[model samples]
Target: MASPACAATVSGAPFAAMDFPLQPRRPTPGQRALAEALARGEAMMGEGIEQLPAATYTDPDRFAAEMRLFRTLPQLVAPSALLPEAVSAVAHDGYGSPLLLTRGADGRAHVLANACRHRGTRLVDGDEVVGAKRIVCPYHAWAYKPDGELSGMPRAECFPGFDRSANGLRAYPSAEIGGLLFYAEDEQADFSDLRALEPDFDAFGMAGLHLYERRVHDVAANWKLIVDAFLESYHVQRLHAQTIAHFFADGITVADRVGPHQRAAVGRAALLERADLDDMASLRRAVTFTYALFPASIVVVSPDYINLLVCMPQSVGRTLVEDYMLIPEPPQTNEAAAHWQKSWALLDGGAFGTEDFGAAARCYRGLASGTIETVTLGTLENGIADFHRRIDAALAR
Candidate 1:
């Protein structure tokens, strides 16, 4: 049986749940300061003449710097649930390199460079490999253990002084925290800073959630531009009016920063009339929370599911975005499955992919035309401002 919160509906609507199981924990000092700032109407006023030069979005040099920042900083790659069992591996191509994530026989998660040690050929191209004891390069048949150690080569005698132990797959620094898998090019990169950004992350039960579907979209826009689309609700009333506008209050968003990361919430208009606004449960049901993890990942939480968007830069003018929809569990009945499918079709296909990202592409072309010198952000769009500030800080390092 479903939990009452899960089964609850808004005035008899099938997919309209009035309450969500996950509630925001008590705000930290930084979060409290942000709340007080919002209450004082400070966050609603424009931050005065802020300008992100148009060249930053179209210059090849700036794009390369951004990619360098990504490689240096720790990034959330996938949810831990992707590799559910030992010998299970998943291939991801969004990052700078092809990545292979596997659960070793020892029950530990590993992130390995997917390229073969010899000839640098990708070992797998498909999304997933199940019950695999070893990974064999399709080109030269070089084999590797589940733990990423080189196990065999086609003919060992051909090369003199060839050491198998020294030829293992390159492993990136990684950790599974709050059910998310994070990796960085720096083998000694510290994830403590990233983990501190969302201390209550585990309370959301993200580890237990299962990936429902994954979609990859190639957008003709700068990666930062794609991320900017999700940082604010200012465009929803206009761009997403046909889809999600009716569900949220226009321009009523609150943003809080945790180090370089940000959490923004958009209130639902339907909940304003509720008598239980003081309660955490009721409050959670009345808003949508979006977390912009520093760099290029956005995690949006709704009552019934979570959407993760990861933007990967292909060039100054091109980006590849991987969108994953995650649900608490797999649907056990046809009715449940159908409901999720319809919900996904409306949210992912209509609002997110088509309306949001599609508009981003057009925005990029305009920026590239050099007609505008700077993109302005209003007080309501402080989340976007914060996002750009973080990028500037990262690149400055």
Candidate 2:
């Protein structure tokens, strides 16, 4: 499972191998209540429904509290399609936390702190330094290997007890599933048991997948705001009327595990049972399966490829989203690449791109003002509400 270098480093190593605590097979009391509320369409439904307190999404103190929660809480951030070749990690410094990603020649993933251990410099700037074994710090000449090992430091003699063996870069606890890698940065948090959220590569159909395209979004909103927008299809009939409304339905169903991870299903029977899809064989491609992996990642899978949306907080009011379009396997020819590109462009240029971002930005600005005190989430938006509730609970702990 490991290359020669990785094997040698890990073999009989003193470092405690990451052991995730096994979550119970059954859902907790909170899960049962939330599930029941979603089933009955009560928690987030009806006129004059008390909105989720706006302070949760707007106030600076609230934002800071949430940030600390995400950074320290024992929540699982779901894996992505590139889990084999890329282990995405998120960490915080004085300014803000950045998502760091890395992969080895052997296809193992490792998410580490983006900053250099020595001088606090970002080791990864963008997606350019991917698939490389050597990562040389841009600020200083401090160099390190892919597995978080320091092969050389300029002045080794000056720093006493500076054991290169003990100075490997910090590695957040991460595990891969169905082509995605899930991780948490809490050092004392136990994550050895992951049965609560079993590996669902087959259920998600992520095996043998390949990268298609990456969409980098500098969204001007809180990460949760964007995630909340993506969690529901209630807006499909109205907000997305110009684009994806025709393909999606007005209703939704949701299911959750012990962790923050949850799955939302949208009815595609309209397309399957309707005669309008008679000519489109691909429409039988199965219903829309949207998985919100734990903390801050959403994996949207269709018949053709998987679209992954990852939200990383930039500031109290801003977020950096890295969106990727992935296919089952690499394209074999120019025609295939062209076909993928066309689909990507249509999705991005059309509703999923502009409409989603545009509406989310407006919502954030409105929240920023004191006018709105609460945001009401509907039954179809249960997934979104559940996410917020889960976040609040985790942070409250």
Candidate 3:
């Protein structure tokens, strides 16, 4: 489908375009829960304090369970905008397996195993492959079509009874929605958890947005800890006081869950003075919407751009984070470029890297000390509790 058109502003200049309309003013059921929970001064608590045991972060068995949850369940792999054209492909290594995402000749995206079926050789080595008609295995010179079909073999006549069709690359079960690509190792894995966020996904124009920049961080903490840090605003005043503390209201947040995914918005200090709380779109302008897609993806929507943080677990105490900054469009002029550059410097460089992840590293040291039996989540930190509950549920199943 064609993208939505950009409207004109009062001065006749083109307004920044978005694929979907602004979110409605009426509160969704989840939003209402958030409002009520805030009024009660209670954060959404999980089953019990035992839900977050220290071993959940440091134990090998728990880490293995978490890894199984990641591989067997549907997880966000890449944004649709990353493969905008035919013959485009990107390699990902976050899901405990090497994955190759390719846009085929028909312009449909596909997720395939990166290993060649011929001799189990890696077809593409780097993070992305663009404008390639076929994936050629470096070891055997076997080539496969972008859709994972076996196309050519080096010595076909050597094996008279060889069946090329049976040697095609293995493909993972994948789905594209709201401009994002999700895949799971288990072909029968259910994706209703992700599909339930269609309304919020569309409202944010996730699919139509362009990826502006990306940064990778190797954090010294469990993946869950990093997820917890982003979903709450309780630490903003103390941790980010020098950077973004003044911009946001302290200790005030609203959160609601859409199936396995959860979203939380912390009020901006500038808008706290306004009496009206009914206009959702206006409120969105004043707050940052943090959507934690179960398993490990967190998409943070600010007024100007979107930040996609993928927490990829590497070991019990190490996680690789890929942070992507997506904008409505590429900057056309020097002024626009400078503005986006400054935005990246503040959000990704200053606030996230320096403050958030830095704190996570220190927190990991304490958790690994073996003194604390369990960590606690406050009422305002309900998102963290909800996340742990989802993890336990997924592992149980």
Candidate 4:
């Protein structure tokens, strides 16, 4: 259902609420458990404490294994809304592999190497979206359709074999669902597990949302540390005291995962007052949901919009984060633009950039410096615990 006003409360602090019409999403059984748990006022408890070696984050061998694991798994690219037209193309470089994301007349999204089949030249360059029907190689003018089907070359018979049908661009597996795009570096990557996310994405009306703004943060931290910062709320109260600390109930986040991906939610004190599940107003004010799309991406359902973050690792101590802010619709007035602009500023530069990521970078310094032998996670950080378990399994494979 459409969200009502959003509110945040802090002890000895003034209460606050924000009114914005967010796209509606159905409440699932997971969310039901979240509400009930809040009503019970229970502290977060898990299987107890877990300790992981600091080398897990700083070892060169481990970093190579992690990179291998990430490539084999599917990664969230961007909202399909960014390339809604049947014939469209966008160049993306944040996924470690330079890619040309295209939607053909068949309405299926395709993720292909940005390099042209000839001389491995980049067929498309830059970040702007292209609506051309054929991708022409900048070097030789060899043209191919959006589906990567080779159409013609400067000389039809000059090349060996001269077979256009088998000379298309190299491609990886890709899919489009609920307005989002996903691809894997492995062509045989199985995507059945991703079906679990469609219902949630549909509820958010993600397919129809507008792309408000996008920013990239290349920070000094291991990529997993960035994800770790978001997998729990233990730091929300203290780390975000001046920003969003008053907005949520401390230490009460509920989490569950599908395959390696996790869906989690944290509620506010007002959550106890929300008696009806269908009451969108109280529900919006009381709970906020976060989706940890494994390997690389995170989608946060905020009070009025959604934030999608894709974290790509460059080395044992560096990461690049691409953040996209999605809204219900395009801003039609200056006031509306200002509304999203203000939200973007606070989140991009303030909450995520300075607080969460900043902390991750500092932790990386300590871990890499060999000051800590192991990273200790308490029961409250069950989500982070689960995160490491998934990684361990992948690397072991």
Clashes of 3: 2
lDDT tens digits by residue: candidate 3, 1-397: 0000000110111123232344354444554444344444443333433347788788978898789888788888878888878887778887678899999999888999989887788778777556658888889889988899999988899879999998788998999978888888987899887887766666666777778888789999988888878666668778877766665545566666677777765543434334134554444455456777887888877656778888889998999888888777877777778777877877688778777888888888999999898887655565666667778887887
Stretches of candidate 2 off by over 4 Å are 1-50, 73-95, 98-100, 115-124, 137-142, 154-161, 190-198, 252-258, 270-284
lDDT by residue (tens digit), candidate 1, 1-397: 0000111112212245422344444434543343344334332435554567888899898888888877888887887777777887888878868899888998788889999989999887887656658888889889998789998888888978988888899988998877778889887677887788544455456777888888889999998887887776667768866766666545655666666777765553445345143333343455455777888888776656777888888889988888788777787778768867876777679887888789989989999999998887665566666677778887887
Candidate 2 lDDT score at position 109: 68
Worst 10 residues of 2 by lDDT: 1-10
Error of 4 at 152 (Å): 2.2
Question: How large is the C-alpha RMSD of every model relative to the true structure?
Answer: 5.3, 11.9, 6.5, 3.8
TM-score each candidate.
0.86, 0.74, 0.85, 0.91
Candidate-wise lDDT, in order: 0.71, 0.56, 0.71, 0.76
Model 4 score (lDDT): 0.76
| lDDT of candidate 2 over 201-269, digit per residue (tens) | 343445556767776677777778777765665676687666555554344333445456665434333
What is residue 349's positional error in candidate 3, in angstroms? 1.3
How much is the lDDT of residue 117 in candidate 4? Answer: 82
Which is superior by TM-score, 1 or 4?
4
